[model samples]
Target: MSLSMILPMSAFALAASISPGPVNLVCLSSGTRYRLSQGLIFVTGATLGFIALFIAIGLGLYSAMNVMPGLQALLRWAGVAFLVYLSYRLAVDDGRLTEGDTHKAPGFMTGAVMQWLNPKAWLASASGIGAYTSGNDLQQVLIFASLYMPICWLSLASWVYAGAFLRRYVQRPQVLKAINRILAALLLASCVYLVLE
Candidate 1:
């Protein structure tokens, strides 16, 4: 790829990664409850998941599924279900910060699997690959993945730290409730977008 292509692609990837979405919310919650080390694991897993997603899309799997409206619907429902589950957990969190309150950071395998069920992850990966990838050249796809995934990882970390910084102020019951509600609403909106799309 030309320098022109690479720079623009990288910029696009970074913007997409940094945008507010389900994964970022989850990372934020994780960071607030736990430590950055655990939050970074989530970030790493998510980044690898995006890299794998780019590979799958490059292999034409996403396009094949894209052409099948039924498959798309199935994917949408699956994403909605997963998001609802996540939102419920967050919304009902008790106003306590006991030791071991945080769940374990999902492993790389879980993160990779969640990509298949996360609508935002799908949309972002599809958008990045669709906009930047040229032809089916594996090398180019790998190049894109290599450059993009680290941006995603770092962007997620930034959000996690931002959340951690805000956690002190937001841990108050009313503030946490509002934050949880916002997350739930966003997840619901994501679900609606998936079905409508």
Candidate 2:
């Protein structure tokens, strides 16, 4: 890829990764509940998942997706279901620091699956690859994925850190519960938006 192509691709990756979405929201929630150390695992998984999606798109999966309308519909519904489940989990959480709470924090697989189920993730990957690369060149696809992965990680980690910072001030159980509830509501709202969109 040329420098001109790299510049626009970088800008798009930054914007897409930094934007508030399901993945970022989940990262924030994880950071608030578990802080950065554990939260980094989730961020890593999400970034890797995005990189995989970008590679798939760049390797002509996006065109295949366009041909299969039913596949997209299935993915959308799956995304809605996953988001709803996440919202419920967040809503019922008590925000107490239990001995096993660390284990309860979402792990790498959850983060990876969440990105796969996220429609915005799919759109961003497909659009970025489509706009930046020509045909299904593996080299170009790898280049795009390589550029995007770090940007995704940094954007998500920033959200996690922001949540960890808020954790310091929101230590009270009631306040933490309120914050979780708000985050749950936002996740639920995102589900609705996803379905409607």
Candidate 3:
């Protein structure tokens, strides 16, 4: 791809990756609730999942939706249900700062599976692919995915870092619980958009 194309593609990738979504919310919660290293694991899985999804969309998975319209509905409802389940878990976290290590962080498989089930991930990949790529240009798609991988990881990591930073102040169980509830609410709101659409 040309410089012009690459810049736009990179910008799109940055925007999509940095924005708050289910993956970022989980990363943030994980950071607040567990170790930064644990959150990074989820970050890695999410980034890799996004890269895979983006490349698939670029290669023709997005077109598959057109051929099988029901697939879109299936994905939509599944994403919504998954988000609701995640939100419920986030909202009910009762651990204190001292118990951070005791509370399990979301694993790599959870992150990857969450990305696959996240409506935001699907939309971002489909829209970015549609805007930046030409018809089945594998080279361009690969280039975009390469650019996206690091950007996505770093962006999500920032959320984790932010949560870790908050950990210093929100040392009380009550405060941490409030934060989790807020994140959960935001997560639920995110799925509402998917449902509405």
Inter-residue clash pairs, candidate 1: none
Please give, for residues 1-197, the per-residue lDDT of candidate 2 as tens digits: 68988889889999999999988988888878894778899999999988887788787787888899999899889999999988998899898644346877888988898888998898898888778877888898898889999999999999999988888777877777888899999999998898788
Residue range 1-62, candidate 3, lDDT tens digits: 68999889889988998988889899899889888888899899888887888888888998
TM-score of 1: 0.88
Ranking by TM-score: 2, 3, 1
What TM-score would each prediction reach against the true structure? 0.88, 0.95, 0.94
Error of 3 at 55 (Å): 0.8
Give the runs in model 2 whose Cα sits over 4 Å from its true position: 98-100
Q: Which of candidates 1 and 2 reaches a greater TM-score?
A: 2
What shift in Å separates residue 20 of candidate 3 from its native position after superposition?
1.2
Question: Candidate 1, after superposition: displacement of residue 176 in Å?
Answer: 2.3
At residue 51, what lDDT does model 1 achieve? 79
